[model samples]
Target: MGKATGFMEYQRLQEASEAPQSRKKHYKEFVMHLDDAQAKTQAARCMDCGIPFCNNGCPVNNIIPDWNDLVYNGKLREALDTLHSTNNFPEFTGRICPAPCEAACTLGIIKDAVGIKSIEHYIIDKGWENGWVTPQPAAVSTGKKVAVVGSGPAGLAAAQQLARAGHAVTVFEKNDRAGGLLRYGIPDFKLDKNLIDQRVKQMEGEGVVFRTGVLVGKDFPAGITNWAKETVSPETLQKEFDAVIIAGGAETPRDLPVPGRELKGVHFAMEFLPQQNKVNAGDKVKDQISAAGKHVVVIGGGDTGSDCVGTSNRHGAKAVTQFELLPQPPEQENKPLVWPYWPTKLRTSSSHEEGCERDWSVATKRLEGSKGKVEKLIACRVEWKDGRMQEVPDSEFEVKADLVLLAMGFVSPVQPVLDAFGVDRDARGNARATTDGAGCYKTNADKVFAAGDMRRGQSLVVWAIREGRQCAREVDAFLMGESVLPR
Candidate 1:
C-alpha cells in the first residue's frame, strides 16, 4: 500500500460538479473528474485490505488495489495500463457504471468507500490527455476472421480483443453509428458521443473494422431503433467469419400494456432517448418526441427512467414525475449484514437532484385521453405482502400528463435477430448461451457465440464488457484450439 494509515489521515473527496440550475441549461457533462492531488489522496485510502472483494465485485474483475497504489504513487501510465488490462473501455464504465466494487470495498464496512470510480475516471482521462492510450495491434496475424453483431460495449470489447489477438474482426451495427446504446441510449450530458468516436478510431487503428448502418439480421420490428440501409444475412456471416459473437443489447423494452397503450404521446424510453441523442449529434428527426412544455410522467425507477427525467428537464417540461411499482428501499444499508455484496437501497440519480417528483408503491391503471393523445395517467397506490402486491382501497388517482415515457427496462434481445441466426433462445428470449464449460458462450448454431445482454438479458455495461472479453477468449480458443487472450 502507498500509505498504510492514509485512511485515518485523509477523508473522501467527491468530484466537483456543475450546479443544477446552470447545468440544466445545456447538454454537457456536469461531473468533473478529480485532479491529480485529489485522486492521489483518494487512492491512498485503499487501506491495504487483505481480500480485495472490490475486484470480484467489479464485473470485469479490475485489479483495484494495484491501480490504487499506482495512482497513489503518481504512476499515472501504469495505473492506466492496469485499468485497460481488465476493462477495454474504462471511460464508459467510469462515467456510467454504478460501481458495485465500491459497495464491496472492505473499508466501506466502516467509513466511506475509497473513491475508486473517481480514480479510474482520472486515470483514463489523464491517459488520453498524455496520449498513453493507443492502438495495440498484435505482432502476428492469426489469419482468422471474426464477426461481432452489435457495436455496443460487449461487441466493441469482443472485437478489440479478437483483433488484438491478430484475428481480423468486423463489427456490424444496425444504427448509423457504431456505439449501439452507448452513443444513442445514454444522454449526451452523461457521456459525450466523441468518446465513442475516439475509441472507434483507436480500435480501427488496432485492425478492428466497424460497419455502421449494417444490420446482421434480415429485419427488425418497426420502432426498434434500426437505422440500417443495408442488411446482411446471418448465413453470409457464418460463411465468411471463423466465429460470430452476438453481443447486441436487450432491445425489447418491457411494455406497460394498459388499455390506452395505443394512445399517442406515450412512448417507450428507447424511442424517446435515441431521438434526443440523434438531435444532439446534429441530426434532424421528424416528429421527435419532446417533453417541452408538457407535464411529463416517467414510469419505472431505473437508470432509464432517471434519464427520462433529466432529458425532460432539459426539454423544459412544465413538470416531471417518476413512478416506481416497487416499494422504496432503505436510504442506508446495514453494512454488517451485507458487506462485500450489493445491497438494495434507495438511489437518487443526478437527474433526480436536478428536479423530479418521485413516488413508490404505485402502479398505473390506465391512460386517459381524447383524440388518440394521452392526457392523464390513472394509477393506484399499493401495498406488498409476501412478494405479492395489492392495491390500497380508494387509493386511485389521476395526474395530468401530456407526455408519458415508459422506462421499465428491457426484457430481452430483439427476437428477430436470434431467429435470423437460427439460435436457441432462453425463456426470456435472450440468445441461449452459457458463460462456462468447454462449449461456453457458444450457441447450438455452428460457429455462433453470444455474450453480454444478448445472452444475459438486461444488464450493466461492465457485465457486457466482461462477457465480451471472456467470449473473445472462447472464440479465440475455438478458432486455434488454444488461446493466450485473457479470460
Candidate 2:
C-alpha cells in the first residue's frame, strides 16, 4: 500500500472532464488526466488493507496495492510491469472499465475510493511515453503453433501470451483490421484507434501474425467447421494451427419484436455506432446514419444506450431520450451489505452526463411510423411486482423519434461460427467451456478452446483479457505437457 497515514491525509482526486457543452461539439476524448504530482497524491490514498479486495474486484485481478505503493514511492516502471503482468491491455481497461476495484476499495466505505483507474491510466501512459513498453519476444521458439480467432482484447491477450510462451501464434480477424470490437464497437471518443494500432504494432514485433479481412470459412479453405460466414473454416484452422482458441465476441443483438420494428429509421446500436467509428478512422461510409437535425430516441438503458445518447449529441440531434424498462436504482448503495461485490445502484456514464432525458420504469409498446420509417416511439410507464413488469394505467406517452437505436445488449455469440466449428454451447448460447482447474477453456471440439465474450457472453474488456490469458495457459498445457504461463 501507500503511506500508513496516507488514506486519512490525502483525499481522492479525479481527472476533470470537459464540460458537456464543449464536449458535445466533437467526437474526441474530453477527459483530462492528472499530472504526475496529482496522480502520486491520489496513489498515496491507497491504505494498507490487511487483505486488499480491489484485486478481487478487478476482473483481471491486477496487482492493485503493489502498483499503488510503487507509484507512491515513485517506482513507475515497476508499477507498469506489475500492471502488465496481470493485464495485457491496461490502457483499454483504464479508459472504459467501470472500475469495480474502486467500489471495493476499503477507504471507499467512508470516503471516495483510491483513484485506482486513474493511477492505472497514469502508469500505462507514462510507460508508453518513456518507451518502457517494448516487445520481449521469447528467446527460443517451442515450435508449437496456435491460432486465435477474433482479434479483440481477449484474442490479442491470448495470442500474446502464447507467443511469449515460445509458440508461433497467428490471430485471424474477419474485420478489415485487428482489435475486433475494440476497433469497431467502442467509440473513438472513449478509446482512440491509434492506441489499438500502437499495441497491434507491438504484438506484430513480438512475432504474433495477424491476418485481417481473410474470412476463415469463406476466404480460407474449409478447415475445422465451415460455419464461419465471413472468415476461415474451423477445419482449415485446425489443419494449419496446432491449437485453436475461439475468442470472437457476442455478435447477435437482442431484438425487440414489435409492430413497425422493421422501420427504416430503427437500427441496432451496433449498426449506428460502428459507422461513426469507421468514419472517425477515415473510412468512406456512404449514407451514414446521422441523428443530425432529427429527434433521436435510444431504447434500453445500458452502456450501449448511453453510448447512443453521446453519439446522438455529437450528431446534433434535435432531442435525445433514453428509455429503460427496469425501475430506477438508488443513487447510492448500502456499502455494509454489498461490500466487495458489484452493487446494483444507479450508475451514470459520462455519456449520460453529456445531455439526454433518461427515464426508467418504462416500456416500449410500439414504434409509430410513416413512410416505413419510425416517426415516434409509443411507450408507457411500468411497475414491477413478483419478478414481472406491468404497465401503469393511463401512462402511455409518445415521443418524437426520427431515429431509434436499440441498445438492449447482446443475447449471445453468433451461432454460425460456433456451429461451423461444431463446438457445444451452454444454455446462455455461449460456447460451452469451464474455467475450473480441470477443463478450463476446453471446447467439446478437439484441440479447440473458447474465451472472451463468445465463451462468457457479453462482458467487460478486463474479463475478456483475463479469460484470454487464462485460456492461453490451458491451450499451452494441452499442447505441451504443462505450461509455464500463469493462469
Best by TM-score: 1
TM-score of each: 0.99, 0.97
Predicted structure 2, TM vs. truth: 0.97
lDDT of each: 0.94, 0.88
Candidate 1: residue 230 lDDT (0-100): 96
lDDT of 2 at 307: 89
Model 2 lDDT on a 0 to 1 scale: 0.88
lDDT of 1 at 242: 92
